[model samples]
Target: MPIPDGPTTYRELAELLRGRIEGGEYPPGEKLPNIEELMETYELARQTVRAAINQLASEGLVRTVTRKGTYVQARLGRRRVRRNHVVTRSRAGMYIFPAAAYPDEPWQTHGTPHRSMEAAPEVVAEQFGVEVGSEVLRRRRVMSPEEEPPFQIVDTWLSPQAVADAPQIAEKSTGPGGYLERLEEAGHGPISWSEITRTRMPSAEEASLLQIPGVLPVMEMILVGRSGRTEDALEVTIRVIPGDRVELVADLVRDASAQWPLRTAEPKE
Candidate 1:
């Protein structure tokens, strides 16, 4: 095949291949033309073709495995995570909901929680209305979906007083009733909760831990569980979800009292 009438740069070659991928000429999971073939086809150098392939890898449109030729990555199907409790809570009300939002696909999440006590950060202090440096139980968990990449990273902070007797909250699994039930038993029953959503490029550590590609932003959900009709939050949990793999939906009701579309506390400065 003749090279297109243009400067045969790496970018131009990548664009040509990208067009093929988008045109379905090379279907998902199908191996692309090998480096030598691409170089000969595009009349480019080996290094030029390699750079073009790397471009595709960085864009997450393709994957290159060791000893395995590069293949077009399957377009990632996203799970719809809702803000409604109906979507979040199971019918049993005690057990945690499955991470796989799709009913057709059976997905299980494995969470490894690293528990520790850390002084409250300035933002946490403001969110919980506690003084900075207050002792809070911090549980950082990475929830990996079976047979795929990670689902989300969750960090939960509880007042020492709230989880003093609730040792189960620190474990990998809370077993029955989850942490909320345990907290309620400890006399800190959460009446209502709020969340703040934001998006940003993942940090180096976060990208490594989540096993995602470069510049892929992550959706952050900051949730605060509060006691009945009180501003004092009992627990603050933050979930980091891959923006590429998660979509959130929430039903809205027009109310003069409520300001935001989602039920979330004011962001701390």
Candidate 2:
């Protein structure tokens, strides 16, 4: 592993193969060692190891099986909570409230209930700052996790006085307590949260609402949720998930002379 010399930058060979696949020295389903053996073991160029395996397959950490080659892709699990911490545990808690307050229960008569449809799309109305025809609410959800299968769809929107002070935000169940505790029990107290994530290609009604099958690719996750004392934007969700069972944890705190400027074009009028 001596490489590092003159001009090798694909973000420094993708941080030296992401520190040799996070130091297991490349393990998880293995494979990787092609592009002419990673340009003869990192002496570089084969377009810098194919731009460092396309930046580790755009950071989901590799997986490009065409004729079957670049492997290793299964390492993103730890995040049951915290990081924009919202917290919610029992008594059916995670925000699914309005099935006419559970009319004849049985998990609110087995599926399909949370509905508030309309207002979004203009890229979710500029990611929830709103005003592209106003009135946003579109709430649709579906999260089944114990032993899986309903995988998650979540559409969320809010802001009609945060759904008229939580008119049970249209109900569905799996979260009778957690959209930041029904946005602090409807007084709307979420402060500021962001999220953003990528990897798309999903609409045929979101590939049949996330049952996902064809070449499997969803992982979208927009999530905005703000408000604590006028940060404004109350909620915006979008989820979709199922990139082999979601795991998106972001904790970044490094500050060694922070400059971090990588702005791609958006202002040239």
Candidate 3:
């Protein structure tokens, strides 16, 4: 193999490897070739190969074990389906629906809630467009899914008016229905919900709640729901989900090709 004349940036190498991995030539959980092998094959310096692998690892495309070699991390791809729902490409593309109607009881029957009637945090205040230190309805909950360990730890902050109107939220338990549903019932329909998904090693408290051993990475879903003119609304942060069990779905629609070229001007010449 011959090394290219110009400098070989890590981005270039990462793109090459990423293409191979996405193309299924290097399937998920498959160990990548050793550094020496990669250097020999690409005819690049060892440093270049290391840099490329580092880039991949940072992007969560690969994982490196102490004694073991580097292996591909399982990548999740989502397919849009319907409003607030998505078909995950993994798990054979299972459909995940949004939380339906408010619940009459707590999501988990075993635990208590932590509630505070105080000023919201800066982040929360900014999101809700309220002044810092303004009174807000704050509740923290640890919810278990079925027999599984506590699957999610949610910290929810709602506008004072939003909560006062729904008295059920005054308790430390989950509302009779999901919080979002309750918001809808209060006449604040969500114009959009933005989700930021990632995985990280859980904190000590999170690990204890989830009852998992070691530093197993857990999936985090942060959602900000906005109402009114698709520009603003209440924001909520929910974190920690068992990676193997939780699924996220989204649906998208586009005008069909038949609708293209709506009107063509007549030939003037």
Best by lDDT: 1
lDDT of 2 by residue, 1-269 (tens): 64557336778777877788889889777987878766776677788777767777655577666576777765645224323434334455544321111123232111664665685776577766667876576767676544434555777777676666666655554254555676675665654666677876666666555444334576676767677866767777776765656444548775755546754669888
Q: What local lDDT does model 2 show for residue 200?
A: 69
Off by over 4 Å in 3: 1-110, 117-126, 129-136, 164-168, 171-187, 190-192, 229-231, 244-269
Q: Which lDDT values do the candidates have, in the order given?
A: 0.72, 0.62, 0.64
| Candidate 2 regions with alpha-carbon error over 4 angstroms | 1-25, 29-37, 40-48, 55-72, 75-123, 126-155, 165-237, 242-269
Worst 10 residues of 3 by lDDT: 87-96
- lDDT tens digits by residue: candidate 1, 22-99: 999999889998998887777889999988888887676776655767888766677676645542556667634333
User: TM-score: which is higher, 1 or 3?
Assistant: 1
The C-alpha RMSD in Å for every predicted model, in order, reads 8.8, 18.8, 10.2
Which candidate has the highest TM-score of all?
Answer: 1
The estimated TM-scores of all candidates read 0.63, 0.29, 0.43
- Candidate 2 residue pairs in backbone clash: 94-175, 94-177, 94-178, 95-175, 95-177, 95-178, 96-175, 96-176, 98-171, 191-228
Q: On residues 79-99, what C-alpha lDDT tens digit does candidate 3 reach at each position?
A: 222235432222433222344
**Runs of candidate 1 exceeding 4 Å displacement:** 1-14, 20-59, 62-73, 80-92, 95-100, 103-105, 117-125, 129-136, 144-146, 165-168, 171-175, 250-269
Give the C-alpha lDDT of model 3: 0.64
Cand. 3 TM to true fold: 0.43
